[model samples]
Target: KLQMTREEVLHDIAELTSYAKEHYSTVLFSAEDATRSDLNFLIKANQIAVENGATRINIPDTVGTITPNAFGYIVRKNYEALPKNVRIAVHCHNDFGLAVANTIAGFENGASEAQTTIIGLGERAGNASFEETAMSLYALYRIPMNINTRKIFPTAKLIESYCGGKIKIGRLQPLIGQNAFAHESGIHAHGMIKHARVYEPITPELIGIRRSDEVEQIVKQSIKLGKHTGGHALKAKLEDLGIHPTNEQFQKIFNHVKSFGDKGHEVMEEDFLAIVKDVMGELPEEEQYVKIDELTVLTGSVTPTSTVRLKIKNNGDQIEKTASSIGVGPVDASMKAIVKCFEPMSKVKLLEYNIDAITGGTDALGHVSIELMDLETNQIVQSSATHEDIVMSSVLALLKGLNKIMKDKNSKN
Candidate 1:
């Protein structure tokens, strides 16, 4: 979405306004890729748009790179640089999954208007989603957007047809998705069935969506479990099979999930729990367990090497073991080495990997998050970890994340 360097955007106001004057009623001028271009040029462009009678000047953060605070600052700075008569608008992309955050930031900074497609549909990742932005603005910020909340569904369908990706409907999805209204767990469903206000903060009808009868029938079938048996909450309970986790273990898994995000993947449950027990051996007692002994990784190639060594106190005796392996990369190698040493203990699998950088610098540490899906239960397990060396961070982070998933899973069991 670059505005400079492109003749179309640079000359859009001059050529498009004449066409609008003859036939169209309004002209929307967007300076795409505004975030990456020179700010001085943008100010001049904004002046031109207003001079050409453009009703709106749209500034888009196409890369999803700006934080909410930064977004607000950008809008405020740019708007101040522009002629007062030009109406500022915003179009945001969700590449970093922060479109909603950025949109709010724009409003707080100075934007009086926004352009959003239903379900956030657009190219590359998509624009700021209408449902998330509208509801967030209304519910969280108390911004008065006069658009009818009830029109969300039809609007989403209309945009979905023109766009490529599917707009999955559900409650877990925020506003208009299917699960947004259907309660399935025993405690949640019972409370919701009695008084929906107990679980649902907003009415389904408010977003122009209806709870599917089929989902309700499925809940009825789950009556044997009474109410707390389906959905993610129930799935979480099942993950906690029978175990208490140490604070260290918990932090480890939490870090892993964050690391997975860096790599652009969701965390699952099975791989999470399995890796926990895989590394630490029988759950740590109040004071009887040894800490992680040693981990070495050789990375940056099609194949990598990993070595792990651990020492544990058993029956007043110190026992030690080492494992090593070669795999796709350092991460895979390290995981294999750990498994080799801890085999016959339990099975583990990796479901997803995501990663993101904490800061923008060569020295900035990258956070890696992982999701391990439990094959038996079909539940998602999450963990996150970080390091300056992305690969090493990924391996250690995954191990820590794995530990957390297992610790939580065992606790519930």
Candidate 2:
């Protein structure tokens, strides 16, 4: 408050300085709401503080009402008016979401120190954020500090948890959000895959954060296949998954992706991977066996029943066979029926079956995995299939296992 005249304020400052000199080697004087104060009074107040042996003077934007330009001007004015030895510091609030900007402006204009809080936690909106301030200084302004940046994300996470989820770091938050280093658009992901700096301003490791295999998995999973998707991006994505397709196979996959895009369907990573598996599973006529021609299942209070028609090809000759079976469940019945169609060659036992939902919703993608043991050769193989239909996933998983077993047998012969 300007209730006291400038003379009274100076007198109080002189007394405080005399008292501080007796015990302390350094003193810091903070002028609250200095930004809103009259420029002449603010300058006089700071000068009085400095003249009274204050080693440092802090100008706080208590109400956070100053713009970057104004804050810079104020800092420069105070620096020129204060004693040469007195250091100037800035403490800014984020009421207008300009705290970081104002703080940086002050720094560029000769403020030696910036007062910030972790995750910008403070009264009202909060103070300038530590991560944002420190990162901006180092990355944007080329001003280095003694901060250990690698601990930034982990520290923010710890504080967030301690605050009971109040300190929410948004996905697009500059340095530490989940999507800060994540790429979703095909063009961006492709460029990022080739050269990370293309899309990312800085490497995650610069802040002591390491990108794990899960990061790549998430990037691949979040690929938004649409009109914006590029064939190069799709090819890069497949290669990232270690699945290299021939040019012909890639053209087919690319066409399929475009067809889905044309139909306004966004292809998910799981869906794309499923498509790749389906295409790669195709083989020459002689090598193809255990193909599902048609399948029908009936389930009710009575025992579940399934009828399967399979087309088996051996030595370039194809024959279709139909079989029916019953089980405690529809999936079990389907597997039984499929095995029955193979007769002597179907001497395989289902060792284990597992199903997981890949996505959430009524139309969620389902993944089914099965382990099968060929009794004749005692060869155990595992295979998995993903589809929107759980029943079809189970059947496809079993078929894949059977095909693997047949291939193994043929190789042995």
**Highest-lDDT candidate:** 2
Kindly give the number of clashing pairs for every candidate. 72, 2
| lDDT of the candidates, in the order given | 0.63, 0.80
TM-score of each: 0.46, 0.65
What is candidate 2's lDDT per residue for 1-413, written digit by digit as tens?
56987688778888887688678888888878899988888888777777777898999999999999999999999888876778888999999999999999999888989999988888899999999999999999989788988888888888888987656877777788766775646678677666667777777777757663344643564345554677767776787789888877787777766665566555676667766776666554456577999999999988899999998765456789899999989988999999888865758889999998765556655778789999887889998876667889899888888888888777876
- Which residue window of length 10 is worst by lDDT in model 1? 221-230
Error of 1 at 159 (Å): 5.2
Clashing pairs in 2: 150-207, 150-208
Most TM-score-accurate candidate = 2
Which lDDT tens digits does candidate 1 get at residues 287-375?
43333589888777446988888554444556677889999877778767865665432345677787776656565555677776545
Badly placed stretches (over 4 Å) of model 2 are 1-14, 148-164, 211-229, 246-353, 359-364, 369-384, 388-413
Error of 1 at 311 (Å): 49
Would you give me the overall lDDT of model 1? 0.63
